[model samples]
Target: MNTLKRTLALVATLAMTATAFASCGDEKKESTPKEEPTTTATPEDTTAPEETTAEPDNGDEIDASVKTGGDTFTIAAWNHDDVPYLIAQWKGLSFDTVVEDLADNKVDGIKFIDMNVGGGQAAEKYDQLFNEGSDLDVYFCEADWALKYINDDSKTLALSKLGLGDSKFTNIYNYTDEIGKDQNGVRKGISWQAAAGGFAYRADLAEEYLGVKSPDEMDAKIGNWENFVAAAKEVSEKSSGGVALADTLGGLWQAFACGRTQPWVVDNKLVIDDFCKNFADTAKELWDCGGVTKNSQWTDEWTAAGVSGNCMGYFVSTWGFGGFFLDAAGGENGAQYGKWAVCQGPTPFYWGGTWIVVNPETDNGEEARDFIISATSDEAQMSAYAKAKPEYVNNSQVMDDLIAGDTVFNPTVSGNFKDGQNYFKKLAENAKSIDFKGLITPYDSTIKGNFADAVKENYLDGNKSWDETVEAFKDKVAESVPDLEWDD
Candidate 1:
């Protein structure tokens, strides 16, 4: 057989095996947690009503690779959104036990510090914890700012210390694995979900405005940036500038910025190439032509856009279908429900994702190792969590099986899409192709935010030229990150 056929056969075999394993347990689905809020102290609905006593079946024999018997396992995160649920899956405890008891810090052998802050502010809280020499074992990190801890040897411990070698995580998506590693390629962190993204457009709007009948046609219409811009213009003209093809400038940046082929900073020098100019030009055109919405992201106006039919599409990731996306559809029985479809947009990109990392001072190495295994490596546990949490889990093999087997993750969310399409399938295609091996930098979060702000204020809003916008971006970034060198 040829190489391609062999590869396909292997994947098919793995899918079948994974499906059998995934069927081993009864899946009890729960409502996904709301997206982390910037100002909220705690996550909404941190406590769940149901009790789950059954532990995930990890086959007959257990692999106790690391030493056990630590007195307490302490986990920390910015909010109660994911850590509580993840720990519940790992400890076989009720979600309520993890959330409520952990909030009071009364769980006998576990301590979960919610921090009660946003993801961006969590770094400072973590630094304070380290300063006080608090008892911290495992912690979560966001993708953009993960390098802050991963690069600090005193903050993060290598997974190898817990016997979690690359062999154990072979089935995980490559881009996630890349983010978990540090500057020297040492494996410092790992994520449980593959947060791959695609363009979810209103099928009714596409039909009315673009004359596209299906997602395939829609994707072909906006397959690349140039084509996407043209399609947006078409939508604007057809709608008489009443509707926008893209959601917001921030959303566009989320999908557009990921296509960069060079590191933002190399050898302590900032790099600004034609990619910056192209994005500015694109944003400016869309801003002027009403091809993209002017609403700032994370506002009520953004969600209202979809409900009011003012926007045609959203660049959404796997996690979004539950929270903001559902709100955008005005809930399950809302006016716009069941009118959406997803396609691998102009480019493959990922939005927000969380990573699990161990503290170098962890006294509970065994619990940390076991938790990571259950959350990330053990196919049985991950499959169960994926179904229960309804997440696009990191393991490619498990997701492949779930998608292949036509497992419906969530009925209500699926009902939000046209014909209840299997949305994970489209996200899976993008997940496999995201290449970010040498692209991550510790200053990524600050730099990306600064650039976007500069573009919005200086180029898109103020109508500045490319060079002037570049200078404004430089000045803004210099205030935040003064160490990097740049041309005047």
Candidate 2:
């Protein structure tokens, strides 16, 4: 709470630094939209919220002001990835309900506005919606640009307004809780998934190159940046430079950046500490020694590197295993299938997460509250969703129970790993360890992405000096965010 208080106090000074930015710069793999589902089934009856009174988790009944039974409830998101499935789970639809069936933009009384845009572009679409006074009751927010709405009272509704309070969200992860709150420490949003990350590696490669047969051994081998570099060197030498210990510079930055102990900006000035230089130097070492592959992420070559045995590991989040990680193994029974495993990387980090925010002008506040509760608060629904969508749900208690129960979120993805490892268990450890409390800034997405780009282009790829790299990073930040005071 002290961190949140401190963060809120700094908002007045730092607010201007992000108000000019239009898009989320945090890079993420988005879900591909599908046309329709192959099978059609009737959506199950949904449970409606109680009409007059609501009891919060702390055993206090509050007078609910939000009215229910609106003619239509509208929800919006950039893509069809999450909202569809979330709706399915909330409605008690069959766990096997095909998401594509809801992609037609209609499911019962709910009218989904599929902006069909990238996460970065969703803000523009939402702006248009708000300007037109479109009927939007609930909307999703990416962690990066979430503050753009959370901080705007006119855009986001406080959960307390709907009779939901802290007690209802007591079981969620800490890092995610911080991101959903706005300046002054009011909860405006909540997420359903925890996008924690870890280093996923080829089990055979670790054993062959580093003499590490288990994830525990591999984790110890690269426990810190220093040890990680040493292990990379060992892998490079043993493999005759044919295989790299890591995947990409971008991947390395994702893990390393989270270790930052300071905000990107303070007092309207950009803060470029030793963390930046250290990352550049580390990335350069990997680039020069072939410790990491040159292939860019989200590309065919990136996935092909794994199949051809050119790359040993990838820094992956919970959502990735179901998507790109499968491709890296060349699909089920493919070349690299069943040879993979995951370990806690050099540091604890989270990649991408989506939050549910209510529109302040919404008429279906009760429905919004109920939907959020099902996705984020209610243990049973969250647990069902965790396994059904193969998601790493945001509720820590639910995830802990699932992990203890040895629940397999996805079979094909687990089967692709060595010994069919339950990868979510590793991510849960990371989810609990991530602490981005007072450290979050609205400009974080842009600054982090810009910093990563400068490091890759100037230092690692261009062979520029460290000072030159710093200058390049500064120049990029200046262009992206001109409001900050540059320390020359």
The parts of candidate 2 lying over 4 Å away from their true place are: 1-69, 95-106
**Model 2 pairs in collision:** none
Measured with C-alpha atoms, the lDDT of residue 369 in candidate 1 is 82
Tens digit per residue, CA lDDT, model 2, 1-488: 12122222121212111111221111121111212212111222222221223223323332355555677999999998888889889887654553655665436788888889878778889999999998899999887788889888789877777767887888898888888888667788899998888999999989999999988898789977878989999999998999998988778877777776667766556677666676788888888889999988777998899999999999998888978888989999999999999998777778888989998788887788889889999999999888888789998899999999988778898899888787888888877887766777677888788887888888877888887886677666655655554332
Decoy 2 TM-score against native: 0.86
Error of 2 at 474 (Å): 1.2
Estimate, for each residue in 183-215, the C-alpha lDDT of model 1 and write its tens digit: 778888999998888999999999998899988
Every candidate's lDDT: 0.77, 0.77
What TM-score does structure 1 among the candidates reach? 0.85
- State the local distance difference test value for candidate 1: 0.77
| C-alpha positional error of residue 468 in candidate 1 after TM-score superposition, expressed in Å | 0.8
